[model samples]
Target: MRRKEDVVRGVAAGIAMAATAPYLTLKLLWLTGSHVGARDPKALDSLWTVNLLTFGMDATALALALSFVRPWGRRAPAGLVAFPMWVATGLLGTILVAVPTDALASLVLGPEHRTPDQPHLDDTIADWVFTLVYGGFGVQGLSLMTAFVLYARRRWAGLLRSRIGDLPDSPTRNVQRAFACVAALVALAVAGVRAYWAAGGEVGLPIHWVEQRTRSIATMDAAMAAMAVAATVATLVLVFRIGPGRRLRGPLTVAWLGAGSLFGWGGYQLVAFGTETTVKDLPSATPGLMNLVQAGQFTAGVLVLAVGAMALTERAVQREQPSSRAALSGTEPPRDLAAR
Candidate 1:
């Protein structure tokens, strides 16, 4: 077969990259007080900090997008490709799916119930600013995920041939199932908090930041918890071989991505929360709420991470079949070669 290049996919990735430009530009504009997309002057205290973190995320997405068409991406270290992709899938997956629902709820329930608003969390950006930023994130996530699928399929087509139910029986499988069960339970609890918060209920462990930025934290908590729930459920279903047998690749993919994203998002939040912020110094007389969320999230992350590691390891060490053995027979196939 003649080696080919995916020009169409490359174009798609390029378009996604272009969409991010305006969002990043607007974020930079906030620092200069251009207020291009704002109804009010920026009020978020950690403007630079938030922008800096988001800038890195966009840059990583851009790099992943470029890798879809470039030679280096195919050759990039697996960890390099995996880490960012996992994060993108985890964070953006829920947001992309929920944005419209959230907007609808916000419209119907009224602005007061949209999310628990903090003292000044969103005073910095206008509604349009978020539309652009989140829109860009959604696009970038979809594009990167597409690119990765193509890249991974081209690179390791044989590895994916096996389905979830076909996973070999081993101690690792049992361990993974245990992890999944615990993760599912934790995710369920977290999801309750999220659902409550999203519904405009005050249920989180009261902290100064939660009180100040109730809506923002609530939104995040709700979203993260929900995503974790989906991931853990998918993982457990696959682990137990409940519905789909070895034939179902779709649930397997969901389990993999959901679990990975759950861990990635959990780890991201744990680190972000652990880090000292400007809010730490503010004076507050309210007795701090017993915040188990941070610890719970971290624990859930560790379990999910363990589960993912076990699954990936199992996939890696599975016995190779004839087709895969032949494909790996010392000849480098063309970069764009499709699996037989």
Candidate 2:
């Protein structure tokens, strides 16, 4: 019998693991007082904390990449592996598409975006080091996603079979519908903010607003908002199966990515705030109007995350029910007999 799982994807995961090493190493060096990439000698805050936070993120990616290639990952609890990977996919998926496009745009348009003034790398070999780090992130994203897909396809074909619009009777349906509706509204509000920001309308400004006026920041903010809105709406549509034809693939993908970005980034930021890593980025005194925006985004992200999780769980349970019935009646599934 052929051994299950592609050996090739395993190798690809190894490559991804290796790709993350340089970034992790550089961060380690920085944490220990090496400042090879430092641009400002007197940067407003110590970068050690940020470096550690980034290192942990990359480390998680490394572990995830390894899981795809190894037998151990298959043996582990499926949801445990799946959730972080899903979150990573959402966050990294956006960057995987955006960064290269941004690079290309900068080349053609001659660097129209405003670069952050502080915490920059020197524009030389040091900068290339930072590039390697970010480049590793993109590579980790693409490689891990490819590996996960191959792994999922081979391992659980049945659970993957449902169409997007299929609605089943669930005890949580009422709760999910209410949550999704509220979440969708919040996401729309965020999308509006992003649009306004993209168009250069500043409703609530901190002093930092002046620095964010560059084409790059506006474009990025707009893109994030638009994408989040798409995902949010798509998720709500999928959850409610709203007035639909087969809108599964596109909407499902959008919802997955959008939920991941919002949850992963927002959750990370919230947690990182308690740590030294994010304190440098946190606003002082008043929580500000942006906090409201963030709160909405976070809520939407979380609710949609619940929607996706429940959907996947239901699919898995559906697959197992037939087997459970046969076993309880002292018979085996047809495939189980064939295997023996």
Candidate 3:
């Protein structure tokens, strides 16, 4: 069984790494002024920074895919391996869910025509670019997520099996509750805004943004909103111990992916187009309220992550107590609590 699992992990990691090549190559081409799939080469000039950032992100994904199968990855510090994987899962996972839904919606609704002023996805990018890049991202998300799950199960088997009610109450429960509440409110706000936009309510959007709305854009908005809600629900449940008998792994997985999506995509947009970027000609709000909302989403994600980390750390310390006592008394700790 172990050997079979290892083979599966290796194959998945290989596919993930293979899927990055097209995206990485395209980003590199753009960065080097080779407009391989760009409609207007100069249109990409202002997006050099965005391209570089995405390139680095994909490169990191490539490295992570390798780490998923390599023995050294097992020995790496937990945080070092987990953090990047979480972010990768967020970015790619959102794409994985959105792209197919978008395609189906497009098929049902038909394609919307856009004016020259509106920034449609195909405005600056070629048709083939979306196909190649998104297809790669989809494959990468599926394979990388699979590999990570297998890796995590091997390394943290006991934690995965533990129930939420089994965890000892943290001394900082009040603090956790406070942060969780704040994070939940922010997530709901973020979800509300995105959901409104997805449903074609355009109160806060610039004219160009409203005009540029397509099935794909709407699908992405809906996905982000769903992720925000999921994160909120999962985090609140875990923090408040709402489901006493629930396995810790389920909520943790949802919280991880949801919070990661909030942080990863929110941060990407905030950095990529939050400032004076020519990527999209968005309308001007009186005080950049939309930007603040984006920042708030990112902040909420951070709060969720911090609160979850604190809870897990407290649990880990408490779990270690029995083992430490056992060592001192020259007796073995329960096998169920044994380190993976």
Candidate 4:
């Protein structure tokens, strides 16, 4: 059973790592390009490639998440609420709002339209798509961050109040807390920026015109990138702390893979932001970076899903073993049955 679990975790981790490579490479290419034209044939090709990669990653995440249901004793009430909210926000904001806006803007405005310029038919549609999709993603991210923070806080409080003496803080606990905080902050910042844009107002009051507008957005992007890097590093450190042992190997391995996914995804977010922001003639780099970040995030999401799956599987196996279940549950069999 232990060996089987390890195999399952290893395969999942390998798939996640493989998914990140192309996505990351494309992002780096765009970032370093002397001139990256969004409408350029090459840029479009890169975009399609990233889309394909992310599709695969998302599929994997869904599969892994499904696998966890049996053992986790069905989805927890909290997860039930949180997961749907995250998915809905992601779909609505990205597909419904952001994508259409960006596509219309590109088609009608010939890829050069600025806000308030009464974009061409195609440009207008594109703008609407971009607004909703990106906005949705940002909202979804905020929701997940909030959920994770609450979960971590609960765990921390339980640990502190428990009778388990000499329980030193694990690296996993510390990293998880750090990630929760960073995720929450990123979500807040993104939300604030979106709100500012929605109100037909830009940040950096009065000096909003000229280079300041671009600079202010760039600064926010940079800050997000830095936090992502920190989170990735912290997650990796936690991964290395998984000790070697037969019985403990499966869960540890799954957790490690999940951490790796987080690291890759977080790192990619930073790179994608840098590439998009620094590109010349780019409308803010958000569009170009979308697919890349999605790929990384999906990959990380899969690993986390795998962790849940392993936990569920363990629970299922335990239930099947009546002796183990009886011991843990403290339920004794009838004396007559025992005698028989």
User: Per-residue lDDT for 1-340 in model 2, tens only?
Assistant: 1254487677778888888888888888777777666655344135456668777878888898888777788777877787888788877876775677677778888865334563222422365775786688888788888788777765654434446655465787887788788878878887888778777876754434544355555665666676678777787788777755573556776777887777766666544432232333533222356566666667778888777777767755655677789899998765622211
Worst 10 residues of 3 by lDDT: 278-287
lDDT of each: 0.64, 0.69, 0.86, 0.39
Rank candidates by TM-score, best first: 3, 2, 1, 4
Most lDDT-accurate candidate: 3
User: Clashes in model 1: which pairs?
Assistant: 116-214, 116-215, 117-215, 118-212, 118-213, 119-212, 194-222
TM-score of each: 0.76, 0.83, 0.94, 0.31
Candidate 3 per-residue lDDT, tens place, 143-197, comes to 9999989888888888888888876687899898899999999999999999988
The residue-level lDDT of candidate 3 at 13 comes to 94
Better of 1 and 3 by lDDT: 3
Per-residue C-alpha lDDT of model 4 across residues 56-99, encoded as one tens digit per residue: 54443343333332334123454553343333323222333334
Which candidate model has the greater TM-score, 3 or 4? 3
Task: Count clashing pairs, candidate 3.
Answer: 0
lDDT of 4: 0.39
User: Candidate 3, after superposition: displacement of residue 163 in Å?
Assistant: 0.7
